[model samples]
Each structure stands twice: as structure tokens, then as C-alpha cells.
Target: MGAPVSVTCLSAPVSVTCLSAPVSVTCLSAPVSVTCLSAPVSVTCLSAPVSVTCLSAPVSVTCLSAPVSVTCLSAPVSVTCLSAPVSVTCLSAPVSVTCLSALVSVTCLSAPVSVTRLSAPVSVTRLSAPVSVTCFSAPVSVTCLSAPVSVTCLSAPVSVTCFSAPVSVTCLSAPVSVTCLSAPVSVTCFSAPVSVTRLSAPVSVTCLSAPVSVTCFSAPVSVTCLSALVSVTCLSAPVSVTCLSAPVSVKCLSAPVSVTCLSAPVSVTCFSAPVSVTCLSAPVSVTCLSAPVSVTCLSAPVSVTCFSAPVSVTCFSAPVSVTRLSAPVSVTCLSAPSLSDVSLSPSVSDVIISLEVLASLGMDIQPG
Candidate 1:
């Protein structure tokens, strides 16, 4: 048989063996097995499990209702499973697999592969050079026991556990958890929270949610949380954190940093090195331990405290408090609300307070 043959509507189990010819088998309701020796084969099944084995020619298998298993020895393989689980194993050539309903498991011993899953979990174990996987509905778990991997998830949570190669993950709807044991990782979350814990590499996280929390513990971390009720904490790394809403808190234990809070009721705390913090609304507090600190508050009821370095505090509206224990302190209060309080205490250094247009009873001091 050297010509193309097409078979349709077989209600019993169908078995095909083709040699040096093209074959197209379709509309089968039972189990189908196809073995192509040297020619290409295309198999489509309606409600049955399909098994395809290709020696040196390409194979394309499409299943609508049952699980599909494809094994390719030399040429490329493309498998599409609509309602059931899919398993694909390729030895030398590339493979492209698409699954719509159930779980998908793909293992490529050698060769690059691309896998996409729509409604269930995806598990990919690649031992080749590179792999790309995308998941839409359920959680995705990828174990890159070998090469570099790039994963993008849309609806559910994403968990990437990488051992040696770098991983990049992007999530749109649910939480993203990345545990990088040896390589660097970068994660971006749009609607849910993000958690990253790295053992030996750096991490960068960005979260955009209404009440999102970002926690990073690694070598170097940069976090940006862009909503209300945001809390960012970094331990044992150089951290640069930015919070863009009210009731925000930024805390760093061991690094020099710059923090900016764009709403009211904000707090910034640093342990070592110089820090520059800016608050754009009222009820702001800045506390520093060992380095020089500069704070700017645009609204009322501001507090700045420095333990071992110079403090520069600027307040645009009233009820400001600036206290420095061992260095010079500069305090500026612009417009005081009615019954506002301005208290400045510099223990061993000079204190300067410039109050402009105090609408109520306030204190003004000028050094001559």
C-alpha cells in the first residue's frame, strides 16, 4: 500500500499498520491503535482511547472523549485531547500537546516541547534543553528536573519547583508560589497574592490586588504592592519596596533602602544604613535605628524618630512631632489644622522648627 487511505465510521476497535504510505483514520467509537512504520499518520477518535506509535514518520492524534497516549521515536508528534487526560512521550523529535478537560502529563526525554492545558492540572517533566508550558483553568505544577522553563498561568494557582535552571512565572487570577532551590526566579501576580522563597538565588515579585500581601525571603528582593492594606516584609536582603495605597507598612531588617508611601497612615522601619522615605498623606511614621533618615509627610500628624543619626522631617500640614536622640533634627510644619500639636525634642543636638501660617495657637522658634 503506497497511496493514501481514509477510513471512517468504525464502531469496533480499529487497528492500523501502515508502511511507506499515508493514513487518515476518523470517526471511531472504540479503542484505536495506529502503528506507522515509515509514513505519516493522522488518527481521530470520537469516544475511545487512542494509542499511536510512530517509528520514523510524523503523527497527529485527536481525541474527543477518552485518554490518549502517543509515543514517537523519530519524527515530530502532535496530540490533542479534548475531554480526558493525555500522556505524551517523545524521544528525539519535538512534541506539541494540547489538553482541554482533564489532567495532562508530558515527559520528554530529549527535544524541546510545548504543552498547553485548559481545565485541569499540568505536570511536565523535561530532561532536554528548554520547555514552555501554559495553563488556563487549574493549578500547574512543573518540575524542571533539567533545562530552563517558562510558565504562564491564567486562572488558578501556579506552583513552580525548579532545581537547576532559572524560572519565570506570570499569573493573572490566583496566587503564585515559587520555590527556587538553586536558580533565580521572577514572578508577577496581577489579581492575587504572591509568595516566593528562594534558597540561593534572587527574586523579584510584583502584586496588584486590593488587599495583597507580598513576602520574600531570599538573597535580594524587590517588591511592589499596589493596593490598600498592603504589607511588605523582607529579611536578609537588599530590599526596595513601594506601596501605593493607604495603611501601608514597609519593613526591612538589614539593608539601605528607599521607600515611598502614596497614601495615609503609613509606616516605614529600617534597621541599618541610610533611608529616604516619603509619605504623601496624613498620620505617617518613620523610625530608623543606625543610619541617617530623611522623611517627608504631605499631610497632618507626622512623626519621625531617629536613634543614632541625623533626622530631617518635613510636614506640610499640622500636628507634627520630630524626635532625635543623638543627631541634629530639622522639622518643618507648614499649615496646622485647628487644635494641632507640634512637639520637637532633640536630646543632644540642635532642633529647628519652621511653622508657616499656624491657623491656631502654636509655637515658633528661630535661632539668632
Candidate 2:
């Protein structure tokens, strides 16, 4: 309403772009981008990337160091990435990102953008509109084609593609791909090949210095890796995964799932149900449907199942088997040669088996 205020900022090897009608703008410490179109906008990207874009609306955006990628279209969105690699994309909206030596990318369309140190390369692209792209590293390329997008790459190479729903990608030293269909999607990859494709709503995939893969079709999907060779896939569901070692796989379809693999070689599968699986050593597997199941294994192989009820199975040492049928079941097996077969229908029971207790009861339990 006051003849559209215009401001430009600079911080050496940093770029700040501001266009169209503006109300107020400021950039401190590093290079930043701000675009205000016939509205009042305030943006601060401290150590992260905070981008705010609004049409005839007031917006405020801020970001810290947490690898937080939030993409909101047609409104105001706030995000923070703290000491981690995170990406956020918003079309006609507001988004933020923060990093400490972490990879990050933030993109906005017809909105105000603020990006900080980044430490990695930052790219923003667009067409027939105001598009801003900035890179902060040597030998880094920032590319934006058709409709104002932002892409950031690290010491290596990073690529991103978005159509209609605003996509964001951040890579520390690996490759990440995100495909969004009518929703906000964020994909962050660190030293691995991570792919998130074909979703109907908000979903996030994160990989950290591990060989990991995650795929989601709908709902909220989250995959975080601190290990090697981890895989997760979900369709119209929420999948939470945490890995600390090699070879962990999780698959879910229209269900609520939680998996934590601290050791190696763990697998889980679920359909239209809730399942919780935790593996401590090598080799643990869980497959369930329409029930609440928990399987915990330490230093050996273990298997468990529950249908229409609650089940918990814990194992220690080698070659232990515990099976329960149709009830509230609990099996605690320690130091095999021990086997338990329980069938307690519609009741509450606890069965404890130890090799030392079996030997005390005049039964010979061989320890292999």
C-alpha cells in the first residue's frame, strides 16, 4: 500500500534475489533470497533455509539446524533443520531449512525465500515467474527449470524433480529422489541411494550414511538409517524405521508399523494392522495382520505371531522357539535348550522357561 518497498542484501559469494512488490526485507550473515508480491513478508533463515511465499497474505518463516523439510502450498509453513540434512518445498507457501555442515534445499514459488550458510550447494529454478537459485560450494551446479524450484547438492551430485505439489531434495554425499502427486514430499539422502515415490499426502524419507531404500505410496512414511542395507516400503500407511546395522527390511500396506533394528539382518512385513519389531543381534523376522505384535531378539534368531490379541516374545542365546495361540501371551526364553508351546485361549498367562529350571525338574535339556 506504500508504493512497494524494495531491498537487496549481500554477504560475499552469497546471492539474494527480491522482485515484484515488497513490504520489508533483510538478510544478515550469509546469502539469502526474498521475493514479496503485493504483501507483507518477514523471513529469517539463521543457520537453515527458510522460504516464505504468499499472495495477498502476510507470512513469517524461520529455520534452525535439524534436517527439517516442510513443504506447504497455498499457506504459510515454518521448518527447521538442526545439524542434519533436510529439504523443504512450498508452492505459493512458506518453508524453512537449517543445517550445520548438513545438506539442505529449500524452494518456493511466488513467495519470499531466505537461505543461510547451507554448507552444501543450493539450487532454485522456475519459469514465467520469479525463480531464485543459489549455490555455496565450489564445483556445484544449481539448476531450476519450469516454475521456480530449488535443488541443492553437496560435494557430490544432487538432483530433484517437481510437478504441481512442490518437491524438495537434499543430499550430503549421495543421491535422493522424491516424486509427489498432489501432496508435499521431502526426501533427504546421506551417503546412500534413497528413493521416495508416488504419494498422496505428507511423507518424509531420511537416510544417513547408510545404504538404505524407502518407498511410500500414501500416508506419513518416515525412514531413518544409521546402518547399512536397510529397506522400507509402505502403501497408504505410516511406517517408522530406525536402523543401526546391516540388512533390515520393512514392508507395510494400510497399517501402522514401527521397527527398530539395532543389529543386523532383520525383516518385517505387515498388512492392515499394527506391528512393533525390535532386533538386537543378527537375524529377526516378523509378519503379522490385524493384531498387536512385539518381537524382541537378542544374540539369536527368533520368531513370533499374534492374531486378534496381544503377544510378546523375548529370546536370548541360541535355538529358542516360543509359540502362543489365541490369548494374552508372554514367553520369556533364556539360555536354550528350551522350547515353549502355549495355548491359553481368552485368558492372561505368563510362561517362563530356563534351562537351569528344566534341569532342576528332572528333565534333561541339552545345550547345543
Candidate 3:
């Protein structure tokens, strides 16, 4: 141990207490710091405004409230923070990433993963229904439709689909319609939707022969004549005919009117202006009342025979008028008419008579 030393200075008197050689001591002006060259040593300070600095070959220095640097020769390298203020950095592998409050399962282990949402249920229709669906993107679009409905569209996608309800197809142009009574509607491709024009019928009718005149009729329109039959093709389209329900025109030729009895060619006794007789089918026979050597028959074969001569006969409007010629005028057996008149006027009064006969087997003569 070193002895105590006293030192007198102008400013103050100081004393030093040292325990060993090469130790540090101080007065009121300086802080008392103790150092040892050998082993461990301890020192205490009892005054304020004191400062101490330590340096050693194998030791660390720590300053409570001053900027100081310390170096340790050898130490285990480890970093741990517990119940103290320390800054730390992480340098390790990674774990998993989780999203909160997710009902469906989703995991991102791959670059491109598919996330699917549950699709709506599809029911069965007679024609068509949604079979399946898929998502190409985050969100997907859907449509549903059925068949057999007639469709007319101005601008369409060429096709459409429906999931619910039976489809009805009709033509806006002509009277064409496609109805789905019990059959479900189908996917109507504009290329060929059930055509409204395509239909079927079960009945056919025919007439035996022509009437007094042949007439063809269509209630709504007219029919086309094929051979002797009239056929109605489309009820929707325009029906037209030349002679619809009537003859095109009645053709009648007027002949010189004259009367004839059955079989014999004799002079035709016609009254007033030349008579007009209508020539119908079949031959007519004319008979002369006065029989000469022979009866003269007219050349015209028509039922209405034209006589070359005009016989004067005055008569009034009566259904039947007959005249009885006396001995001079009558040469044959002349039948009496319903309304009979005797001979009149000249010395040989020639009575003229007219009678209507049908299908009589009597002799007829046409006058020259």
C-alpha cells in the first residue's frame, strides 16, 4: 500500500489516499480515479462533477451519460432482445399467406389458379336446357332458351336461347305461324327455325262433272285449274281465277227465226218480220201443212231452221193460237190448237197458227 500524501496549492489544499503503486488520486479540482496495473481493483467517487475514463488491453469501457466507444477483443456472436429496447432485423425463410373471412377455399401456391363460383341449377324442358357452364374470366355471363317458336327479327345474332317458357314462332311477312302446344321450344337457328309455311292437311275433295255451266270458287280467293280439276294451293297467298264461279261469257248465235214440225221439208209459214230461233244441240224437224208434190227442207242443220220465205201470220199475245184453214187453205190433217180461230179476209182466207211442241215425232219441213 502506498503512503498518504498532502499537497498545498494556491487554489486549495488536497489529500490523496492510494492503496497501491501507480494509482490515480485527485483533489477538489479533479475527480479521484483509481487504477491498478495488476489484478482487479475497485474505486469509489463521493463528489459531484466527477469524470472517469478507463483504458486497458483486455477490457470494455462504458460511460453512463457521455459519448464513448468500446471494443471487446473476443466474444460469442449472438443477438437477442428481451425486456429491453433493441433494434433487430429478420433474415429467414417465408411461411404462408392467409386471407380473412373467406367461406370458399382458396390457396395461391400456383401462378394461375382457377377460382370457380357455384352455378345456378338448371331444370329440364322438353327441348333444351343448360347442361353446364364455365368461367373464362373473373365473372361470366349466361343465357337460356328453348325451340319450335317462329321468329322474325330485324337485327339478330342469328340465334338465341331460352331456359324458361314454351316458344312461339310466327311470320311477320305472310300468314305463317308455328305454335308449340305441348312441344317445348327449341334453339331456333336463323338458318332453319321451324318454318311457319310448312304445314300438313288430311282431306281432299273432287267434283264428278260440270254443271249447266262449270264454275270454280274459293271462299277466300280462287283456285287454279289443272286439266278439269280446280286446286287450291295456298290459303295465305293471293287466289285468282279468270272464270270464278261463273262461265267466262255466254255465247249465243242468232239464226233466222222459223218454226218447223217433225220430219218433212215443206214451206215454213212465218208471220211478220223474220223470226229469231236459238240453235241448241240436236236436230229439229219441220213439217209443212200444205203438202205439195214434195216438202222442201232448209239447208241450215241448226235446231232453229231458217226458212227462205216469210209467211204472213197475224197473231196476238196468247200462249197457244191455232187457225183452222177451210177447204181451200187446208190440204192435210191439221190438228186444232187450244185456242182456235177460223179462216178470215180474202175469198180463200188463209189462217195462220203457232204452236209450241216439245220432242214431238211429227213430220217437219223448212220452206225454201
Candidate-wise lDDT, in order:
0.75, 0.56, 0.23
> Tell me, what's the RMSD of every candidate?
4.0, 14.2, 45.6
- What would the TM-score be for candidate 1 when compared with the true structure? 0.80
Over the stretch 257-315, how does candidate 2's per-residue lDDT look in tens digits?
Answer: 88787777777777656777777787776666556777777776766554544667666
The ten-residue window of minimal lDDT in model 2 covers: 126-135
Candidate 1, clashing residue pairs?
none
How many backbone clashes can be found in candidate 2?
19
Largest TM-score belongs to which candidate? 1
- Model 3 over residues 1-368: C-alpha lDDT tens digits? 55433332222423333334333332333233333222222222222122222222122221122221111112111211111111111111111111111111211111111112222111111233221222111112222234222233221211223334343321111121222222333222222122211112111111121211211111122212211222222322222322112111111112122222222221222222233221121122222233211112222132112222322322222122122332222211123232222232233244323323211214364563
Candidate 2 versus truth, CA RMSD in Å, comes to: 14.2
* Segments in model 3 whose C-alpha atoms lie over 4 Å from true places: 1-126, 129-152, 157-195, 200-368
> Tens digits of per-residue lDDT for model 1 on 296-335?
8787467778777788877676477777777787766666
